[model samples]
Target: MTTNAIVTTPAIQRLATARAAVVKAAAAAQAAHDAHSNLLVKLADAQARADESLSDFRSGKIDEATSALRKAIADADAKDLQKMINDSAENLAQLNDASNGAMLAEANAKVAELYEQRVEEGSRLEAIISEIESKLLDAVVERYRVQAEIDPDSLKWMKIYKPSPALDELVRRGRVPGF
Candidate 1:
């Protein structure tokens, strides 16, 4: 009923809000991925070192000393590797423990879930935006159609931008019944 108002303004506002959320989610997701990736790298390095240590210990003390040295070294260096693995396994649920180097899994999972949800929301926003754009174009064309009907000056102007000659020819032929 209000001719002056652009009907798509509210949707555009909603789109801005949605875009902000998407940006935030994407950023958090990237940060989480970076952290998880770093922890994994650390775990990998620790595992390699532990493997080499265990291998050296095993090779050097292969006889009667094998069992005792294996036990001692495994107890000491094994703890380090185990702790690293556990740290890598930590997730958002272990946030408190994570702060102290105990959990990465929970944070990784939560952020990944958030990322998925925000991406879906962003997709919905994109769909609605596309719909609004399409309808707005239709409204513009209808406005031009109506103006071209009554005003010869508008008809002349419309002719210049006609995508094809059909609409222009219809207007040129004068306002007929169906048209």
Candidate 2:
């Protein structure tokens, strides 16, 4: 009886090639997913920092405006203004406080607007990531379906063609050549 070395057929080569392509595509998709996830984390952190900065700015502006108004009122009292002037100065102080409040409110609204924009951007990124993941899954499934269509005997030969691990360590490491 004569024994011949097993030869790899064209179909087996194609299957192996397809599998490699699928693995590479999956790896690329994973990297992209990681990058998008990182972007989301960074965006959230930036939004938090921006919100804190806005709060600090509002607090500082209010404190400074209040301090200035108090100083003006004290100065007016020291001058012993006539009742009419005193009343006018009091009204002026009230107007200044109202103006400061209005400005602060505007700034707060602007911050809220900016926050909404960031949220929208984040949502867009998430949608893109989801789409990419779905496409990758489809590609993998299609590749597997194509592989399944190959003759079972040819598939078995392809499996046999894979290099066997010679060392126990290699086997323990789950290393398969051409995989």
Candidate 3:
């Protein structure tokens, strides 16, 4: 699956079987990632830890690093980062298309219904995208509410957006997704 090698280095970072380093690196990454929701920030921290761990492992004196790096990758809130990425891409594309009526004029129906449910009454679209972006960010924030959270995703959590029963219906019918 990995077409390229996992490289690191003052030297050429080779993709060899360094089990201890690899395992430790994954754990460290997960721990760092768990602390943040912004994937870029999370992975930046993770990479720093991995780089340090790998460097230490290469030197054969990894005691102090081992304990801290032992956090299980499975414990990560987004253990399936790849899956989340795929889901986000697919969901975003579908929702965007529906909103723009690219698929069909009727596709807008789905988005309008969702808007009615999620957006506050009498709140007109702010430049067409401002409100939607806010909602998505809020939802993602809620997903990582333990740490990387800033906004409430649903009305129950805030006065900003209301819950959409239509959301449940769309999910039930597989009409719209990942709202």
- Looking at model 1, which ten-residue stretch has the lowest summed lDDT? 96-105
- For each candidate in turn, the TM-score is 0.35, 0.38, 0.27
Candidate 1 lDDT over residue span 1-179, tens digit each: 66796544434444555555555555555566567677667656655655655676667744546645555664555566567556645643244343333124334444555666688789999999789768967877777788777674756644534434664465587544456
Candidate 3 — number of clashing residue pairs? 1
Ten-residue region with minimum lDDT total, candidate 2 = 160-169
Clashing pairs in model 1, backbone N/Cα/C closer than 3 A = 90-103, 90-104, 90-105, 90-106, 91-105, 91-106, 91-107, 92-106, 92-107
Evaluation by TM-score, superior candidate among 1 and 3 = 1
Per-residue lDDT of model 3, residues 7-71, tens digit only? 34311222222333445555545444443346545545555555666666677767655734633
Q: Residue 117 error for model 3, in Å? A: 31
Candidate 3 deviates by what RMSD? 32.2
The prediction achieving the highest lDDT against the true structure is 1
Q: How many backbone clashes does candidate 1 have?
A: 9
State residue 7's C-alpha deviation in candidate 3, in Å: 66
Q: What's model 3's lDDT at 88?
A: 56
Candidate 3 residue spans exceeding 4 A from truth: 1-37, 59-61, 64-79, 102-179
